[model samples]
Target: MSGTVTLGMVPVVLTALFFVLADGQITNDFLIAHLLAMGVPVIGPAAIWYWDARVFPTFVDQSADLAANPTAVQRVGDKYKAIFSTRSWYFVVPWIALIVGLTVLNLGFFETVGITGAGDPAFWVYLLFAAWWGLITGIGLHGAVTAVRAIRAVGELDLQIDPLHPDGLGGLSMIGHLAIWTTMLISLGSLALPLAFLLGTEGGYRAVVYLAVGVYIVVIAVSFVYPTVYVNRRAGEIQERELEKRREKIRQLQTQAANLEEADGDTGTIDEVATRLEIQRLRDEFNEYDSVSLYPLSVGIIIRLVSSLFLPIFFTLIDIYLGQLL
Candidate 1:
C-alpha cells in the first residue's frame, strides 16, 4: 500500500488561504492573531534551516593546519566579534524596535482604544506578561544559543589547528563547556517565566493558553539541544578511536627507527624519519587538549535524552491546555 498522508501541508495551505480570504472582512486584531498562529510552525523550520545551512556549516568542524603558525582559534573569536558588533546588530536592533513599538501600540490599544475593561485587570496583566515573555524567550534564547554554538565550533577548530599547543586545546574545550552550561542556564531561566505564568493562571482558558505556549517552548528547546548533545557524544567517540590509531602509528615509527639506525641505508633512514614525522603530527593533534576534553557524542546523547524525556509530557500538557484555549 502507498504511504498514508501523515503530513498536514494541505490543511495548512487551506487554512492559510482561508485567512487570506478573510482579510477583507476580519478585524485587524483577529487578522494579526491568525497570522501569528499561522506563523508559529514556520519558526522551527526557519531556525533549524538557518542553523544547519548557515550557522553550523560555517563554524562546525572548522580547522587549520599547523603550517599557519598562529592558528585559527583567534580568527574564530575575531569573526564572532565582528558578527556581534555588526550583522547581529542589524537583526537585533530591528527586533528591539519592533518589540518596543508593538508594546507601546498594544498598551495604547488597551488604553485609548478602550478594548480592555477595568473589571478584568488579571486578564490584561496575563496578556501583557505572556506576550512580553514570549518575545523575550524566543529572540534572546536564539541569539544567545547561536552565539555559543558558534564560539564552541571555533574553539573545536582551534584544537584541531594546533594539537601541540598546550594552552590552545585545553583552554578552548573548557571555554566551550562553559558556554554550553551558560546556554543551558539561560534557556532554563527563559522558560521559567512562561511556566510560572501557567501555574498562576486561574485554571481555565488563560491557563491553557500559557500551557500551549510552554509546550511550544519545550519542544523547540529539546529539539535543538538534544541533537547537539547527541552529535557531541558521537564526535567524542570518533576522536578517541582516531587517537588510538595515531598512537599505534607512532609506536610503529619508533620501532622502525630503532631497527634501522645502525645498519640501515639512507633510504630506510629517510622513510623512518617521514613516518616519525607523520606519527608525531598525529600525536600532537590528538593530545592537543590534554587537560580538558569533551565527547561531542556524549553531549548529543544527553541532550537527546533530556529532550525525549521531557517532550512527551510537555506536549501532552500543552495539548490538554490548548484544547481548553480553543
Candidate 2:
C-alpha cells in the first residue's frame, strides 16, 4: 500500500511544474485545477496496478483455507494469475483510449486540436495527459469485466462450506475483500474531480468533466459490486443445504428419544436424556444456519464503500454552497 498509495503521488509533483508553466496559464491555485486533474490519472493507474498485484494475491492465497483441496483450488488461483498477467488486452485498450481522447478533444476544450495549438509547447502536455488518462480508464474498464468474471468463476471449485466457521460466512468472508480496497483507492482518486471542475478556467472543462464522471460512475459502481455477487450466492446455497441436514438429524434424534422413553418406566434411561440433549444441539445448529447473513457484506466494509463513493460529491456540494454564500 505504501508502495502504491504513497508512490502514487509522485506524478502529482512531477506534473506540478508543467501545469504551472503550461501555455503561460500559470496561477496560484494550480493545486486545485491542475494537480487535482492530474492526480486523477496518476492515482488511478497506481491503484489499479496495486489491486492487480497485491489484493488478488492475498485473496488467491486464501484458497487453502477455503478448502482442504488446496491443489485443486490452486488451479483456480493459476487462472486468476493468468487473467491479470495477460498483455493481449494491452494493445486493444490503448486504441480505445486514443479514440476517447480524440472525442474529448473534439468537444472544443483544447482549441479543437489543431496545428495552430501545436505551436504552443504546452499543448502536447494537455493532449498527452488526455490520452494517458483515457488509457487508465480503458484499463479500468477491462479490469472490471475480467475481475467480475474471475470472481464469479469461483463457484466452479469443488469447495466445501464450513457451516460452523467462526466468521459465520461459511469460511468465505475473505473473498469480497478484493472489491473493498480497490474501489476505495479508486474512489480516493475521484476526490480530485470536483476541485478540477470548480477551479478550471472559464468553465471550459465543466461539460467535459461532467460527461467523464457520468461514465466513470457506472464503471466504478460495477467494480464495487464484482467481488461479492457470486460469493453471496454461494453462501446462501450453503446455508440452505446445511440447515436441511440439521433438520434431518434432529428428526432422527427425536424418534430415538421417543422409542427409549416407551421402552422405559416412569423414570427414563440415560440414553433417552442423551438423545434429547443431542436433538437440542442439532436445533441450535439449524437456527444458526437459518439465520446466516444473506449478503457477505459486513457493516464496516459497506460503510467504507459508501463513504468513499459519496465523500467527494459531498465535499463538492459543500464547496459549491460556500461559493454561493461568499
| Per-candidate alpha-carbon RMSD to the true structure | 15.0, 4.5
- CA deviation > 4 Å runs, candidate 2: 1-17, 26-31, 88-108, 111-116, 156-159, 189-192, 195-212, 264-270, 315-326
Compute the lDDT of residue 163 as modeled in candidate 2: 62
For candidate 2, the per-residue lDDT at 162 reads 66
Error of 1 at 113 (Å): 17
The lDDT, on a scale of 0 to 1, for candidate 1 is 0.44
Evaluated with TM-score, which candidate comes out highest? 2
Instruction: Give all TM-scores, in the order shown.
Output: 0.40, 0.76
Worst 10 residues of 2 by lDDT: 107-116
Model 1, span 204-317: residue lDDT tens: 345554565566456545544544554455445545666777677778877876776654688877877786788678677666533334433235434744653454445446
Predicted candidate 2 versus true structure: per-residue lDDT over 52-157, tens digit per residue? 7877777667646765577766677677667656852674476656645553454343442222354454455555555565555556555555566666666556
Q: Name the lDDT value of residue 188 in candidate 1.
A: 37
- Model 1, residue 92: C-alpha shift (Å): 4.5
Q: Model 2, residue 157: displacement in angstroms?
A: 3.4
- For candidate 1, the C-alpha RMSD (Å) to the true structure equals 15.0
